[model samples]
Target chain A: MHEALRFQPVDAEPVDRADVVAKSRHLRRVTEGAARGLSLTIRGLRKAFGDNEVLRGIDLHIPAGQFVAIVGRSGCGKSTLLRLIAGLDAPTAGGIAFGEQPRAQDVRVMFQEPRLLPWARVLSNVEVGLGRERSSADAQARAERALVEVGLGDKRGEWPSVLSGGQKQRVALARALVSQPRVLAFDEPLGALDALTRISMQQLLERVWRDQGFTAILVTHDVAEAVALADRVLVIEDGRIAEDVTIDLPRPRRRGSAELAALEGEILKHLLEGSEDTSGL
Target chain B: MSLIDSLPRVGAPKLPKVDGLIPWIVPLAIVLVWQLACVTGFVPSRVLPAPTDVALAGWKLLLSGELVRNIWVSFWRASIGFVIGGGIGFAFGLANGLSQLSAKLTDTTLQMVRNIPHLALIPLVILWFGIDESAKLFLVALGVFFPIYLNTLHGIRTVDPQLIEMGRIYGMTDGELFRRVIFPGALPSIFVGLRFALGIMWLTLIVAETIAASSGLGYMAMQAREFMLIDVVVLSILIYALLGKLADSASRALERLTLSWHPAFQKK
Candidate 1:
């Protein structure tokens, strides 16, 4: 029990291979099992904007309730891939299906900017994506429920204008969940917040993921964020998946823990140097 | 509490909150000065009636119910025209805002029509509709249309593209997208059009009523001018000012009601 307080200089424990292997196996099993159960299949997704060719012959599959993070340099088509999956933009070719269903509306994306309607109250903004004919009271109740899940239940009547940056993002998250979508996609949702706020938000996101089981795909530039939240981190380079690292850290992970830090360093090394072969150990 | 302690210690200087009396002071001072000048006979009565004479004329007209009748007629005509014209303008503006095809089809023609002054069309309108209430209504409608259309179109076009993309990614359909993202995004501009349309409607009504109309404040002013009833003329002008003040106040209240969620309307 005393080891829990500080195990740094006095008792620097050696890294446990059994612990790492257990965490990795557990996360991989859960995700792989979800894939088998949900049957989400992606085959050769190609997206082009004019002649830019943002996503070229890309392919990826996110299992149900699995947190997959896509990290790459800017303009590497990570955002384009997320957008295509979210149905905000149509793919030039190829297909994505949810258990043989070809519809694109099953996915929902949370943006980096909250994009809350300035005129709407926090509750209404959260209710925006709810169907039109649904009663305002129903929407409000759902929004309130979602906010409660996100730990922001008391701020229903507050205007979006007055919300802090972090609070606005929470509202956005609540909005994405209000529909109870099967697939939740995030496009660098915490990119704009301060460092402390980003860490807190990352923790909130992990907690939310734990509570609500849905397929989550996060596109981000931050290697730490990917390592902290994702079941597996996929690095996109030059319009393709360059590396897919299965995170070997246990849940409720600390930020400065040696295991996480080592994983961060390894991921950074792969990101910084292109074409590094990273076969699983 | 001492002045320094009681006063706001932040930002700009504290504006005196004479609250009730603040708005009244300038107008009251102007009236007092005018009344004093007239009472001292600094101006001839034929050229400009004393404040008392104008007040008495106002009372006589009020007693006869003519002032209220004319004001009511003008108000009804202007309001109906404003609503109809403003509605059409708002719809067109939104259409133009969202679709490039609509913009391509209507932009040049609308711009051309906007350049034609509603007053300049007075003769043509009079010829077509025969100096009747229809002509007056048409005039007001035409006058109110341009400002509302311009503002609404500007509002819709200026909506942030990033927000619209976010709405789409959130699984919002087209109608929901328009209502949630487009409409609210363009509301401040819409309000500008609404308020501008209202002001221009009042102005157009007065101008329309002035030309060959047997009833309304503008007609009364013209009739009083012919008879050299300068006090009645002054009272008519005063009535116009009062009506304008009422329209402006109502529009402002509507703006406040419609835009209460806007940051501009929020209390510090």
Candidate 2:
């Protein structure tokens, strides 16, 4: 039911094929004994804040290792849905279950703001991802490795205030990836970045997501970005999934390609039409 | 790139080299004018002694070790009071800031007590502890307590809720959250409170010592006034100014060291 929707193109980048395979194999080995990616099953999730129904009823089933993008207007409850899935906020009704009963450390959320501890050094901030239970030496080793993964090894000792906006986001991504989580949720993480920085961060995110093979759910308002990164694009409207479109585009998909543009246009059309209908009602 | 090369070159106005010496010029000129007035008999020497007289008085006090002894006594008293009051204030602030139950139990009472001008309680303190070291210590501690307590509470209360939420999401326990997120976030404000409390500490000490004491600089100044020793009185005032500046500088240095992660403290 999901193979056609899945885009695992072996020839995505012929030159990097060997490197990708080696990294993915190593990643699999590391996560084999540990709790790997977890599949999400959200049923009739409703969240109301003092009679303001943010999420009317959200039902989303995201399979393990699948990348999903939720796109919607400002108040269309996409963020609310993401927050519920990340377990930051509880649903007013219904339930969300993970396949393996994921621990708090097994899931991580990256917000639009980097949300780095301003007082902590870059390495320390990333080490916080290991939770308070891990040994100091082990956490330090993993944190350094995560920083190196995000191309920030040299910046380990530096303070967050010293880093540029993009660098700060990269540190945040490193922090999220340090735990080797089974589920990674992005709440418009790139929304505050500049256009150029956003694209670079998108590429970095894609590379990490592909390597880690975690269940990734990105909440974004940027249609093009949603289409470019996600295997399946979900258009949320009136706190419901208005349209579920699968982007068959292969990995390492070109930015601003005609095919991606067409998909964006199709998604935007659905979103615009849905808004109009809601307004008319 | 070299450090100097990395510095901004374009549109960066060069600072005048002579600017460093400019501050001394005004003070020196003031001193010269004062000496000239004294020499020319424009002002009575008895009423307002010349700068030289003040320096000579300082020199005499330095030789007799009286100035150093008085300063040391005052410093020790201030230090003891500051540690006691500041420590208690910090503990109370943390308690009130963290738990609503604690706040409900104590914050109102604290606010009510804070309203009573601690200096105004000097007479009561004297009556309770007598005109001894305990009276002065009590006054100084009482005076220093409010600023630290109030600012610490404000600091902890005003810490970014988002960061605290992030800490919670990251699975930090209560202790870890306080140590990592809440405490560091509250530091800048706590430092502000410390500096304010230091000023209050000195002010209270001076007043307490002057009103009833035998040894401190304030007491020495009072003694000098009784003997019509204008130079000694002026020297004591200058010493107070110096001590205040030193304390402030020390706090600022600590602020710079601890808050290096803060953008406001980062060098351009």
Candidate 3:
């Protein structure tokens, strides 16, 4: 346990522009870009818990490599939809399919909280989803590789208690990425971080997604986050998709850029107006 | 008086030091009044000896080694009984907590039997076991079982449902789920049961030995009372208190070591 503190000291540098582009290239080489154009098709995905109807026929198709953001009020079944797709929870009716595969293993979900096991070292928590059957040495290698990708390569042996909020989330991100799934689903993974940390994570995620060319769906309540990160923003209203607005902004879009701000306003107006369609945007 | 002075004393207050002696004042006053009454021929000394006489008798018993032997016997019996009862209680508690059929079938009987004091079965147990170590062990086991069983059951049932669901979602096998989620989550409560059972085991052993026993602290106390050796009885009682305190301190240390991960115990 005393040796566990060896990885405690770490420095987090912001992702450089050239590094982002190069990392994306590296990811494509590794996965052979098999994740491109992988779309999610949801058909009449209905669900009810006893007398309470949480989800009412959520239907949408996410085109491959498209970054889609789902936004909604607290009880709009937004999380339930993510859970259904991640195979964490069963749907009452209807179905969700990614390509031909239906099981949740193909899609990885990053939860809001880091949820790292207190007893496990930083690298060990990242390796947990890799299945526990592997020898310790093999698991350590895989975990170290994942941690390196997240820029925390040196902190592999440290206990998670010593990590900052941003670093812990980075570890969580590494855990999600270790599986190398085709589709990535994030349930407000950065929602709990501070303002500065949240922005940094948002940029990090955008870089990773671009590099890997994976189909990603984010569930967030922040309109700015939705507009900044998504190829298209879908508003979940009363258990249904109220609006699906495509964002025409180019890559490496700034948060307060004129184009992105205009798109944020449009999404926000639609959300607050309780509009059923994106006619204004 | 010398031993009492050896104990650390807090700083004196501005007011008279009388308050420092306040706790002992009442007991001391009562003793002084009783001794005075006895000397004045108001009450017979046979019924209640002076505190000093009791102390002198107690010192003699300690020097004779009779007190230590009795205490050792009682301690051994209690410790052995606790290990046996605690082990069985924990096993049954886990089974009943985890299984619906087992819990339903046994819960009613356990609840009923737990309410009946272990001492109440003393006559029956002695008749069946002939006042041997078996009867004493049985009494201690009976006293220990209820707390250990109930606490273990509570611990198992109280595990966070969300954690269990998380295990299932993560594709953990049933064995993995129990080991990772259920066991750790229930550990704190299980320890609670174990400690309570241990403490009760000692108490019950003393009670059992007092009623009928060839050699034990409780038997020594009863024999001292018959022979008017009040000092021996007092010495035995003090030893019992010391034994209980020792067990409690050890359990507390174990608790702290095992639950080191809890936030409340963060290392400075």
Candidate 4:
């Protein structure tokens, strides 16, 4: 229909809720109630460590069930932004409003490090994600289901010490997923993984995002990753959003496809320009 | 990717079960040489009793019920003092480690007190508790307290902050955090403290019992010394060695049990 083409914006900033509202409508018609996400609206969000202001003011609106990637040079406050969104750290100024004040289990974070408890078995580690319902008797069943989702059900009884780097991160993903969170914030979750594992993990992440419909915000340094997985990619420069690019391409995006490569190149070019300007070179 | 690659690999070479007895050879040899030296008159029994003479003394004391009674008394005192000291030390460690305010209030005083050698307080302890069982108990308790306190505090403080943050993110209460993460993480260090405290516990008890009047392995040794019962004295020394080794083995067993999750404690 002409309506579908006319209503949806490709990508632009400042990213407005109108884009999200329209996109979600179009998405609901396409996927039909698949998303179980909470919309996040951040306004004038600022964070400072002592006098060094990291995030001057970040304004963002993530639509329910959208995948948003934040890419930046180191020290550009991408991780800090994820922390603020996840409620792990308070913003110095401005405010962030989730559509609802999410329940404790409704917001989960997967850190770059697996952070799985070495003392706890894989299944118990997943159960930890259940919060207050950890003792609810059916908690084990739910945790097992989550592990199976991550292809780690057979590893439930194994100690975390024995798991490989990729396996450990998978267990961490299971832990994050077990709670069925509405908004999942990832702080460079795949940064430590090898290239092959990173690709597969990306596929797994995409699959889960599609299946669960959680609003996922991934903070990373990889431009290709940003373009590959994100519906909208926000390039952070100088503590603010430099670009808000929407990848309108279809699902199961080919890794080496020209369209994906072009988007990746465009973002990388922008990042380099900003860096060059910063260094006055 | 093939099924053969996934098949189980052969493990390390198996040791014959008799390999367990390898360590016993030296002890047996030393005892044989000791008994032979006494038998050949190369060592005088009056000065250093033969192994058989010491065993005979042990048998006689066992018959008189004196040996069992003394050992039981020493064992009881050690257990009571260990429980009291270890309990208090563990309580203080938990408080100071978990709370900034508690550490601020007590840690400095504790550090200052820790520098004073606990055994040096014997004269003052005698003046205070008067050579009764209480005095010896106080010495043993004081001696046992510091190691547990230091180790427990260190253990709690050194639990991975990342895991603690993860626990908080997952919605663990303070009690749940301590129970599931902090305490278990701290246990290996606490075991280190336990082993150290056991050594000091025996050391303090020996000094206290020897210096005081009645009823323990040390007291028995002292009485035998007065009567020139060299064999009895030798038996006492051997008992102390046996007791120290026993305590160390017991703690190692406990550590193996509780810390099976640790990489170092995991069976090869």
Write one digit per residue (lDDT tens) for candidate 4, span B36-143: 999999998888989999999999999999999999999999989998888899999999999999999999999999999999999999999888999988888888
TM-score: the better of candidates 3 and 4: 4
Candidate that scores best on lDDT:
4
User: Candidate 1 lDDT, tens digit per residue, A165-242?
Assistant: 999999999888777666788999999999998987887787656545667889999888999889999988878888
The TM-score of predicted model 2 comes to: 0.90
Chain B TM-score, structure 3: 0.77
Q: What are the root-mean-square deviations of the candidates from the true structure over C-alphas?
A: 7.8, 4.6, 8.9, 7.6
Ranking by DockQ: 2, 4, 1, 3
Model 1 regions lying over 4 Å from their true place:
A1-39, A99-106, A129-139, A274-281, B1-20, B98-102, B166-174
Q: Write the per-residue lDDT of candidate 2 for residues B1-268, one digit (tens) a residue.
A: 4698878887867677876788679878988999889989998999788999999999999999999999999999999999989988989999899889999999999999999989899889888988799898888888888899989999999999988988998899898999999999999999999999999999999999999888999999999999999999999988998899899989999999999999999876
Please provide, for model 1 over B173-194, each residue's C-alpha lDDT reduced to its tens digit, 9 standing for 90 to 100.
8997898788988888888887
lDDT of 4: 0.88
lDDT by residue for model 4 over A139-183, one digit each (tens)?
998898777666676789988887889989999999999888999
Instruction: Kindly report which residue pairs in candidate 4 clash with one another.
Output: none
Per residue, candidate 3 scores C-alpha lDDT tens digits across B1-268 of 3686777767843456776688678767987997688678686656656656666776776789876677678888988888788877888899999999998998889899888988899999989998899899888877888888999899989987765765665556888878877887787888898788778977898888889899998898888889886656765676777788789878888888876655654564
- lDDT for each residue of candidate 2 in A1-281, tens digit (9 for 90 to 100): 12221223222334344445445655564556234678999898899999898887888898888899999888889988888889998889989999988888889999999999999999999988888645666888888878866767778999999898989989999988888898999999999999988987888787677667789999999999999999999988888898899989876788989999999988888778824554421
**Could you tell me the lDDT of residue A61 within candidate 3?**
92
Off by over 4 Å in 4: A1-33, A274-281, B1-13
